[model samples]
Target: MARNKFDVDENLEVQFNFGHLKRMMGYVKPYKKEMIITLVLMIIANAAGLLSPYLMKEAIDSKIPQSDKMGLVVLSLIILATLVISGVCMKFRIRTMARVGQCVLENIRRDLFVHLQKLPFTYYDSRPHGKILVRVVNYVNSLSDLLSNGLINLITDFISLFIALGFMLAINVKLTLISMIGIPVLFAVILALKNVQRKAFQALSNKQSNMNAYIHESITGIKVTQSFAREDKNLDIFREVSGEYRSSWMKAVAIQFLIWPSVENISTLTIALVYIAGVYSLDKTITVGVLVAFIGYIGRFWMPIINIGNFYNAIITAMSYLERIFETLDEVPEVADMPGAVEMPEIKGDVEFKDVHFKYDDDKEILKGINQRIKAGSTIALVGPTGAGKTTVINLLSRFYDVSSGEVYIDGIDVREVTLSSLRKQMGVMLQDTFLFSGTVLDNIRYGKLDATDEEVIAAAKAVRAHEFIMELPQGYNTEVNERGTRLSVGQRQLISFARALLADPKILILDEATSSIDTKTEITLQKGLETLLKGRTSFIIAHRLSTIKNADKILYIKDGIITEEGSHEELMAKGGDYNHLYNSQFIMLKAV
Candidate 1:
C-alpha cells in the first residue's frame, strides 16, 4: 500500500547507463535518412564556419601588407559568403532536425501507450496513476531533443573539433600544443562531476514524477476533498511535493550551470597562454597574421568542446527519463494470451468453476477451493458481506485474473485456452462504479458494440429503461456528457451502463451491484427491462437488495472465501442458515422503514 502512494518514488537509484542510449537508437532508426541529411547540413555549416578565420588570416598577412586592395576586397567577400552559407545551412539543419524530433516523439509515445493497454489491473493497482502518466507524457517528451538533435550534435562537434585542431597544428605546432594545455584539466573537471550530475538529475526526475502524481490524484479526488473539507490538508501536501520538486530542480540546474562557466574560463585561460607564448616567439618564421589566425583557431577548437559538454549534460538528463520510459516499456503484461491460443467459439452461457483457489499479490486467499456449475441460460444470484469473495468469483469467470488453482470452463472449454478478446467479447460485465467516457449519450451506449447502429443503440436504451431519462435531456440520445457522466445522477449513470451492456447482447452477463444506485421506483421499472435483457442469457447478479435476487434460479450466500449456502429464495428460507438471516435482516429493516 505504501508503494501505491503518490509521494513514493518508484525508482530512486537510477545509475547512469549507456544501455539506455543504445536502446534509444532503435527509435532513431526509422528517421535515419532525415538525420543523415541533417548531419550533412551540419558538416557543411561547420566547414563554412572554419573558413572564416583562415580567410581573415590571408587578408591580414598577404593582401593588406602588399597594399593589394582587390585582394582584400575579394577576401572580405569570401568571408561574407562563408557566413551566409553557414547561416543557411544552420537554418535548414535546425528545421529538419525539429521534424525528426517530433516524429520520434510520436513513435515513442505511441509505443508506450500501446504497451500500457496490454498491462493488467494489478499493474495499475500497485502504483500511483500519476507516476505512470508522467512516464508516458513527461518522460517520453524529454527524449525528443536527445533523439533528434543530441546524437547529431555529439557526432558533428567531434568532427568540428578535429577539423579545427588540424588547422591549428598546420599553422604552428608549438602554439597548437600550448593551446591544448586546458584539455586534460577540462576532462578531469567533467569526469569528477559526471556521477554527481547523473545522480542529481535522477533525483530531479523522481521528484517531478512524485509532484505530478500528487497533482493528478488531487484533481481526481477534488470532490471528495471538498466534501470532507480536506482542501487545506491537500494543499499542504501539494506544497510539500512541489517544494521538493523545486529544490531538486535547483540542485540539478546548479550542477548544470557549473559546466558552461568552467569551459569558458578554461578557453579564456588557454587563449591568454597562446597569446603570451606567440608574443615571445614572434619572428620571421611565425608572422603576426599566423598568430592571430591560430588564436582564432583556438577559439574554434574550444567551441566544439563547449558544445559537447552541453550535449553531455543533455544526455545525463535524458538518461534519467529514459530509464523510466524503458522501464514501463519492459513491463511484461501479467495477463496475456497464451501462445497458439485459439479464438473462443460462440458462447452458449455454460460456466463452471472447478475447485478454484485465488489470492492477490501473496495476500490471504480471496477465493478458496470453490466449486460451482451453472446450466446454460440460468440466472445465479451471489449474496455476501463486503470482502466475502462474491466479486472475485465473477472476476475469475471473466478471466480478469488467472486462478491460483483449478479451472474455469465456459461452454466446456477452458477459458485460459482461448484468446482474451474473443472470450471477453462474448460476456458483458457491469461493475458497481459505472464510468462513462466523454461523449454523447448515443455514443456511450454504442461503445459496448462499436459497429452498433443508431436504432440498435436506441432499442438497448429502451430495453434498459434509460431512454425516458435520456429523452428528457436537452438533445435526448444526442445529449453530450462529460467524463464519468459527472453531471448526471448516479442512477442515470448506472442506467446508461445497463444500456451499454444490453447493446453488447452478450451470451453471459455479470451485474455487480448494477442497480444499487437506482431509487426503488426506478429499480422496479428497470426490472421489467432487465427481464427482457436476461432472456436466453446466463447471468450472475450480485446485489445486497433481497428484492432483486429473490427470484433468481439459484442464490449463493458467500462468506470467508467460500459459499456457505446455496438454494432458491424459498429453499434458503427453509434452510434457516446464513442466507435466511441475511434475507430476514433486510426484511426487518424494510418493515421498520
Candidate 2:
C-alpha cells in the first residue's frame, strides 16, 4: 500500500546474499563452453608470464657467468614466444567473453520488459516509473563487466597467486615467508571497511533512483509546471535531489578509494621486508640471482592480490544492482489468469453483476453490493457524480480488478474463470484519457486490431466522423503523429480513439467519458454514427452530459457505492429522484450557456 514518491528510497536488503550469485550463474550456464575456453586461455597466459622471471634468473646467474652466448640467445627467443602466445590467448578470451556479455544483457532486458508488461496497474501506480527504468537500463548495464570478466578474473588471479607463491617458496622459503607478512594486515583492513563500503554503495543507489524519479516526473509534468509558473520551485526541488546524489557518490567512492591504496601500501611494505630478510639471512647460499628472482615472484604474487581486491569491489557494486533487478522480476501480478482458466467463447454480451462489492483498499469501500443485469445487444448508461464508483463498475466488469465479494458474469460464465486475453479481446474500452503512440494516423487506429487493413481502418474512422479531419492533414491517413497524438487537438484525439475502439469490432463496448472533449457540432455528427454502431452490440456508456444518455435503454444513477436510481430518462424524471435532479441541474447550466 506504500506509494513511492520522487524523494523516497525503495526498501532494500542491506545484508549481502549469496543467493544472488547462484542465480547469476544460471545466466552463465548457457555459455559454459565459452567461459571454459576463456578460463583455459587465462591459465595459459598466466603460465607463460610466470616463466619470464625464472628465465631471467637463469640468464643472469647461469648463462652470463658461464659466458654461454648460445644459451642466452636461445632463452631470449623462448621469452618472445611466451609473450606472443600470451597476447594471442588474451585476444581471443576478450573477444569471446564480450560476445557472451552482450547476449546475457539482451536476455535479462527482454525478461524484465516482458514481466513489466504482465504486472497489474496497481504495481505501476505505487512506484515512480523512473525507479523502474533505472533498474532495467542502468543497473543491468552495470553488471556487464562483472558477469563477463569479473568471474574469470577472480579465478585466474587466485591461480596466479598460488603459482607465484609456489615458485617463491622453491627459490627461497625464508624470503617467501617474509614477503607474505603484510597479507594479514591487508585482510584486516578490508574486513574493517567491508560493511561500511557496502552500506555506502547502497545509499548511493537509493539516491540515484530518487534523483532519476524526480527528473522523470519533472519532464513528464513540465507543461503543468510552466502553466502554473512553478519553474523556480521545481528547479529548487531538483537541485536538492541532485545534491543528495552527488553527496552519496562522494561517500561511496571515498570508501572504494580506500581499498587500492591499502593493497599498494601493503605490497610496498612486504617487498621491503623481503629485501631486508634476504640480505641478512643465515643461509649464506642465497645468491644475487636467487634474491632477484624471488623479488620478481613477490611482485607477481601481490599483483594478483590487488586484482582480487578489485574483483571484490565489482561484486559488492554488482550485488546492489542485482537486488533491484531481481526484486522487480520477482513481483507477482495482482491480476492474472486463474489456474485452469478457459479461453472465453465468442461473447454474446449478456453481463450481470450479482451483489458485487469492491474496494481498492480495506478502509474505503468503492462499490457496495451493487447488482445489475443487461440483456444482449442492450445499451446501458451509468450516470453519477465524480468518485461515485461508476468507473469501478466497468473496471470490475473488464476484470481490471476482481470484486471483493460476489461475482460478475459474462454470458453465465464467471469473468475470473476465463483467460484475461480472451475476455478482454471481446470488450472494447475507451478510457477518459486517450493515448496514441508515435505513428501514422492509420497506425494508431489499427492498434486496436493490429492486423486490420487500411480499408477497414478508413471505414471505422469514417463511421466515427474522424475521416474528414484526418484527410485534411498533410498526408491524410499516412501523416505521422507524435506520441500521445500531441499534434492533434483534444477533440481530434478522442475521435481517433473512438474510431480505434469501433475498429476492434468488440461485442461489448465501454465508453467512459469518451465524448467529453469533443465539440457539440462533432458530438451531433458522432451521435448519428453511434446510433448505427450500437445496433447489435452491448454498450456501456458513462457520460456527464444527460443529452447523450437520454435515449439509452437503461440508466443507472450511482452515488456513494450504491445505485440511487435506475430507469429510463422519462421514468427517472417522473420519479423526481436523484437522476431527475442531476439532469435538471445540467439542463439549467446548458440553458444559461
Candidate 3:
C-alpha cells in the first residue's frame, strides 16, 4: 500500500448540509418529467379533496331545507366521484415517484462503486471495508424514501393546506383567522426541535457505521478469535458497539416523535378556539352549514401541518446520510494518470532506480538516496533483513507508489510518464501473501489471462507441477476452491498462484518470498519451473532461503535501507560480508532443525 492522505478521525462530524441536497438534485434531474407529472397528479388529487367540503355545504344549506331530491342526489354522486378520483390520482403519484427514486438510487450506487475502483490503493488502506460498504449500501438506502416520497408528499400537504385555507376564508374570514391562531406556535416548536433532531440523527448514522466496521472486522478474523478462545471477549466488545448504536437510534427517534404530539396539541388548541367562536354565530350571519364546513376544513388544515412535521424529520435524517455519501465521493485519488501520459512501449524489462527516496510519512525515510540499474533478461536476487526496503523496491519498480524524489525508469523511459495500465499489463507479481478468488481450480489459474484456453491453463499448472495434486482432488480442475482458497493448504495455494503468474507470460516477473510456504520436494519442483519461467525475462526474487537465489546473475544484500553487499554467493562468502554472515546463520539453523 502506498502513502495516502486519508486521516482516521474518531469523532467524525456530520451536519445537515444544503449543498449535499443540491448535489442529489443532479441525480433527480434525469427524472424531471416523472416528477412534474407526479406533482400535477398531486394537485389534481388535493383539488378533488378540497371540492368535497363545498358540495357538503351546498347540500346542507340549500338542498336539504328545500326538499330538492334531484339536487341532493346529484350532490351525493359528485362527492362519491371526487373521492374516487382523489384516491386514483394519489395512487399513481406515489407509484411514479417511487420509480423515479429507484432510478436515482441505482445511478448513485453505481457511480460510487466506479469511483472507488479509480481511487489509489492507499485510500483503501486508510479506511475500513465496512465503512465503504455502509456508504454504498446503507447510507445510499437511507435516502430512498426521502427522494421517493418525502419531498413530493411535503409539497402535496402544503397544497392541501392552502386549498383548505381558501375554502375556510371564503366561508367566514373571522372564523378562518381564529382557526389559524396556533400556527405560529407550531412553527416555533418545530424549529426548536429540529436542531436536537439533527444532532441525534447524525450521531445515529456515525454509530451505525462504527458498528458495521467492527462486525466486518470481527467476522473476517473469526478464525483467529476462536483459535485463541477470545469469542467471549469479542462478544463483549460487540455488545458495547451495538449498545451505542441502539442508544443513538432511540435518542433520534425520541426527538423525531416529539413533533407529532407537539403539533397535535397546537391543533387541538386552535380547533377549540374556533369551536367556541362558532357557538356565538350559530343562528346568525354564519349558518349551521357554513360552521360545519369550517370545522371540516380545520381538520384538513391541521392534518397537513402534521404531515409537514414528519417530512421535516425524514429530510433531516436523509441529510445526515447524504453528507457521508458525498464525502466519500469527494476523495481525490492520490495516484492517478498524469494528463497526456504516453502509453508504455513494448517492454524490454530494463529497470533502473536513480537516487530514489521514499517514505510513507514525512518524518522518516524508508529508502534513502538509492541508485541501481539492472539490464534486460537478468535475474537479480534481493536479500535483506525485515524492513530493509526490499518489498518497497519492488513496489517502486511497479509504480504502485511514486518516488518522493528522484526517478524510476523502465527501458530508459520514466515510469511516471507512462499510463498505468500499459505499464502494469506486462508485469507479473506473485507476493508472499497468496490470494485466490472463489471459483473452480481452472478458473483461478485462468484469471492470469482471461482469454486463456483450458489447454493453456493445464500447461501452466503442469509447468509449476501443480497438476498432479489438483487431479487428486475430487473434481480436478473443476473443483470449487472456496473463498481465499481456504480449502487448500498454504503450499498448495502458493503453487496455484505461481501457475497463475506463469500463465500471464509477462516480460517482467517478481517473486517476493513466493516459495516460502512450499515443502522441500515442492520447492525443488517450483525451482525448476522458475528456471523455465525466468528464461529471457527480467526477474526480481526476494527470498529468505539463500540456496534458491545462489545461482542468480547478481545478489544484493541490503540492510538499513542500503545495499550493504552485492555479489554472487561464492564472491560474498569469500569477502566475509553481511551476506556471508546471513548465509552462515541460516545454514546453522537449518542443520539444527
Tell me, by lDDT, which candidate is best: 2
TM-score, every prediction: 0.96, 0.96, 0.92
Ten-residue stretch with the least lDDT total in model 3: 1-10
- Model 2 spans with C-alpha error above 4 angstroms: 13-16, 281-283
Residue-level lDDT of model 3, residues 497-534, one tens digit each, is: 98998899888999999888888888887788878778
True lDDT of residue 468, candidate 1: 94
- Where's the lowest-lDDT run of ten residues in candidate 1? 8-17
| lDDT digits (tens) for residues 1-593 of candidate 1 | 54658777666434447887777788889889988888888888898889878887898899988999999889888888888988998888888888888888898899999999989888888788999999989988887777767888988899999999989888899999998899899999899888888889889988999999899988999899999999999889999999999999999999988888999999999999998998888875688889989988898899999999989888878878888888888888877899999999999999899999999887999989899999999999999899999999999888888899999999999999999999999999998899999999999999999999999999999998999999999999888999989879999999999999999999999999988888999999999889988889999999998898888999988999998899899999999998888889999999999
Q: Please, what is the whole-model Cα lDDT of each candidate in the order they appear?
A: 0.89, 0.90, 0.87
Clashing pairs in 2: none
For candidate 2, the TM-score is 0.96
Q: Kindly report which residue stretches of model 1 are placed more than 4 angstroms away from their true locations once superposed.
A: 12-16
Candidate 3 — number of clashing residue pairs? 0
Error of 1 at 391 (Å): 1.4
Q: Is candidate 2 or candidate 3 better by lDDT?
A: 2
